[model samples]
Target: MSTVAIGLLWIFLYDPSNGPINQFTSALGLGQFNWLGDPNLAMVAILIVVIWQFSPFYMILFKAAMVGIPEELYESAKIDGANGWKQFLYITFPSLMPTIVTSSVLAIVGSLKAFDIFFIMTGGGPGNATEILGTYMYSQGFVNFNMGYASTIAAVMFLIAFVCVLIIQFIDYKRKKRGILS
Candidate 1:
């Protein structure tokens, strides 16, 4: 939704043939891609796009966690002379830590494995500006016909993902041991 708004704003604020984005790209000393015909804003642009795409899930998780917090906690914080910001800092945020961490791990995994969006938007072009692990794997196996190398990349991706999940679980376990797994 925010991405759509940004796109609409871009259309309103920039020219088609030579958009404000192009001017910004030119200032950065990068050339345009023949395929996209858009300037070399692919890196920043794709990062923005990925963040936008994943934000909704984060927002929903945040809202659900906030809603799950008991009202008594807020009342107690207020009774203890905690201001709004202080209550959020000492109460709400601590209570939400596990959920936040989980969401963060998911976001990282999703970003690492993302391919469809980058493929459709940039095709890993403009000099590999938006080449992610998944896109790189596809290029290696299909485009370059190096199945061995592609499988290697796949194994690496799996290892990274496994490590991430292990880290999340370890942190969760420690939190539980410390009685912090609220």
Candidate 2:
């Protein structure tokens, strides 16, 4: 339900031909904006929208993880006279670390490859304010008819994503090896 609400909000904010960002900026008393104007505001707004659109899945995952935690941990903590914060810090956090890392990685990949929402929202316009690598690749390939460059961009994006995942996995592996992971 929450996810559906966020998705609807994102759709409402997304305007291919006309966005409300300019009106918002002017209304906020951000000074007379001419050259360095609405695009900046729109970019920020779009980012917020994107994060909001993506957040519900993370929220669900976190909620489930939290609920899945055995009550015994808290009970034991209570017996030990550990406060809620202390118990959370010493127990819940360590348990949730892996879930958080996994969810973050998924979010990063989703962001890097995101296009549909952005395309419908901004069309990578206002001087390319919302031009992500994914959209940029599409523009270069289809819009500009430069398949070679677009392919190169695709390769680079893939490399960057692969490297990030590799680094995260490596760190996780090391932590597990060192008996630091739960």
**TM-scores for candidates 1 onward, in order:** 0.76, 0.80
Scored against the true structure, residue 39 in model 2 reaches a CA lDDT of 80
Any residue pairs clashing in model 1, and if so which? Answer: none
Clashing residue pairs in candidate 2 are: none
Tell me the TM-score of model 2. 0.80
* RMSD of model 1 against the true structure: 5.2
Tens digits of per-residue lDDT for model 2 on 1-182?
45345545654544333435435655788533332136866677667776766677799999899998899989999999999899989789888988988986897777778877666566787688878898899999999999999999989988888888888888888888887845
Residue-level error in angstroms, candidate 1, position 47: 1.2
